[model samples]
Target: MKAKTQRLYLVLGALVALGGAGALAFSTLGDKATYFYAPSDLAGKAAPVEAIRLGGMVEKGSLVKTGETVRFVVTDNVETRQVTYTGILPDLFREGQGVIAEGHIDPASGVFTAETVLAKHDEKYMPPEVAGAMRKVEGKVS
Candidate 1:
């Protein structure tokens, strides 16, 4: 083949390889992506079947524990949702504290079944999503 023909084939091959790599990257990342939502966001909306991160403050007087299982209500003041977790909770986890629960919501009951519960590491620390929601609430209140 001529040099020009050979160069054209090489360019086409590189483009095809790059496109294939891009497609593969997107396909793998799609499954790993998790969405974050607040309690109010779920209201009047169909519960998502896939795993998601729920961020809000743990409602006061809503925590209940039975053996290894624990249930609590998360709220953004405007809305609330129940969450059930069956594992050792973080030492910082407490009622009236900001938290992010990672798990799937049960569509039938509208209850979040969290596989992992994340709480603030310190008094001043809050998850970004939780903080943003709180700011939005404060903005409306004032």
Candidate 2:
């Protein structure tokens, strides 16, 4: 092969290898990647037994507590989702504020069984993943 062609082949081969490696890594992680959805977005699409991140404002006067398990409803104006968490909630967690719960949903009941609950913080503060989620859904809802 000509020297120029040899170098071109080497570059193309490196690019192909890098692309394949990236595809493999992304595929492996895609299953484990958790996507956050607002209560409105979760409706009809949320599958019971499938773990996901649910985010919305805590409905006023709907938070209930029994022992370490806390039950609340998250709302995104258009819909509400019942969430149950068996862990300490953040001090900032309050009704009428944003919250994100992580857990599996009951396919039949549509209730979320949250293993972790994250509360919305200041305007300048929020989990990066959650922030990204909100950004993703921006303009997609009315």
Candidate 3:
């Protein structure tokens, strides 16, 4: 075979391999991806069937505990969404604190059933997405 023909075949094989790898990576990552949203973003929207990450401040006076389960309301001031979570919560979890909950919203009841609840890591640290959302809400209010 000609040297140029050999080189072309090699390049074609490499491109096919790269394409397959890219497709595999995307498919794997897609399954694990969880979209982030603030309370305001959920208002008047159809509840997502897949798991998602909801972030906002825990509304004061909205925490309710029942056995191993806890229910609370998260708010961005513009809107509020009720969240229910079972199992132990993070030690830092508290009312009036920024939180991100991962789970799916019940289309029938509009309640978020969280599989995992994450609290702010420190007193001054807030998730960047949550911070940006709060700022956007504040900007609208002002």
Candidate 4:
């Protein structure tokens, strides 16, 4: 092959390799991604199958504890979602406070069975995801 033809083939091969690598990276990352949603966002839609983070305020008078399992309602003012966790909760977890629960919603019952529950550490601290979600809800209301 001529020198010019060899150079053309090399460039094409390099492009193909780069495209393949990009595709692989995106696919791997997509599987690991966990999406965030507020209670209102889930209204009127089927619960998702994959793991996700649900962010909202713990509704007052909605918490119920039974042995190691605890259940509560998370609300975005317009909608509510029930969350159940089977482990010790964070010290800051309380009613009328912000929380983010990581888990999957049960398709049969439409309840979120949380694997982990996170609460705001202090009066001035709120998770960015929860803050953003609350802002979105407020924008809709106003």
Clashes of each: 0, 1, 0, 0
| Lowest lDDT block of 10, candidate 4 | 125-134
lDDT against the true structure, per candidate, is 0.94, 0.79, 0.95, 0.95
Q: Write the residue-wise lDDT of candidate 1 on 14-53 in tens digits.
A: 9999999999999999989989998888889999888999
Clashes of 3: 0
lDDT of 1 at 115: 99
Worst 10-residue lDDT window, candidate 2: 130-139
TM-score-sorted candidate list, best first: 3, 1, 4, 2
Residue 111 deviation, candidate 1, in Å? 1.3
Best by TM-score: 3
RMSD of 3: 1.4
Estimate, for each residue in 51-115, the C-alpha lDDT of model 4 and write its tens digit. 99999999999999999999999998889999999999999999999999999999999999999
lDDT (tens digit, per residue) of candidate 3 on 1-142: 9999999999999999999999999999999999999998899999987899999999999999999999999999899999999999999999999999999999989999999999998999988889999999899889
TM-score against truth, every candidate: 0.87, 0.76, 0.92, 0.84
- Pairs of residues clashing in candidate 2: 48-107
